[model samples]
Target: MTDVDLTADPLHDSPALREFFGDSYDRVARFAVMLADQGVLRGLIGPREVPRLWERHILNSAAVVPFLGEGTIVDIGSGAGLPGMVVAAMLPERSVVLVEPMERRTQWLFESAKECGIDNVTVVRGRAEEVDEVVEADVITARAVASIDKLVKWSAPLLSPSGEMVLLKGRSAGDELERGKYVLRKHGLVGSVHEAPTLEGLEATTVVRLQRQG
Candidate 1:
């Protein structure tokens, strides 16, 4: 799989996404290539994910960029750098920290950033709940990491007073929000769901935005 051909895969590339990424296109492309080549071998992504890496993962990750604010970001459970690395690549000026508990995954993040020439990111090896070094992030993001309640609980302490969470979710986002209402109130936060459309053909991503209530 070392010589993986991205063009051969279904839905591997998109011009809209290229323009969407703009100046950061090359870095994001290289990162995708790396993921296609080594993601499964490293146990970061499954073999089935390679073909749909562009549409399902990379493009899906890009959906959160518009909703992000200025300053530092913390991505919880950045397994294979889906949204974290993608965010870093798209927003070179904003600082992104990829927080993962697994040792191998951390190493993979380090390598991916280094090899892709993305210097604005920091790879931190720890769970989001226990990692005290990263604090006051302007925005925190998590993709397929946990339930809505757990995501809020883990992200609460790391967010700045006015910070918010922009989580990537599936069709069950609404349900998750309903289920996490207690936690949202407990944390003095409110939740809303937004539809973030990517390319013309693909399905829009469901984004759950959680912010502290005034």
Candidate 2:
């Protein structure tokens, strides 16, 4: 995907995102095309998802970047590095960990980061439940990883006191939040649902934000 053309890219219309990630425009764009073409071929992305890779996948992942504060990011179930790789490509200054137990997926993540020119990413081979001992992060990111309940159980221990879990969900985000409310409260975490901050007039992604309760 080197030297890919960016004319009329769907993300071009999102000035706020573009301006925020201005320096990483090329890297992010190349990563998107690579994920759509090569990533699909490798069984990383669904074949039918190629057409929507930009808005539905890459942009959706990158949308979470704006909501993130400066700190290390741990991405669980980092299959194909959805929000992880995309975020790593855009924000190279931040430490991004892509955690997955599958060797195939972790291998792809390492190679993909190299191909995408992302230097701030580290690929760790482990499940979300097993990495807490050595992995502490300020923000935990997930996309289509697991149910809300399981996500919290696996991710909570890895979060620092001020850490937040930023998860990407579909239209059922509100429902998931409601269903997970008991677990959130049980774990002393507060949950809120918000429209993924993205370009105007576009179908926004849903975000579930969780913070440690006082």
- Write down the lDDT of every candidate, Cα atoms only: 0.88, 0.82
Model 2: CA > 4 A from native? 1-20
Q: In terms of TM-score, which candidate is strongest? A: 1
Candidate 1 least-lDDT 10 residues: 1-10
CA RMSD (A), model 1: 1.5
TM-score of each: 0.95, 0.89
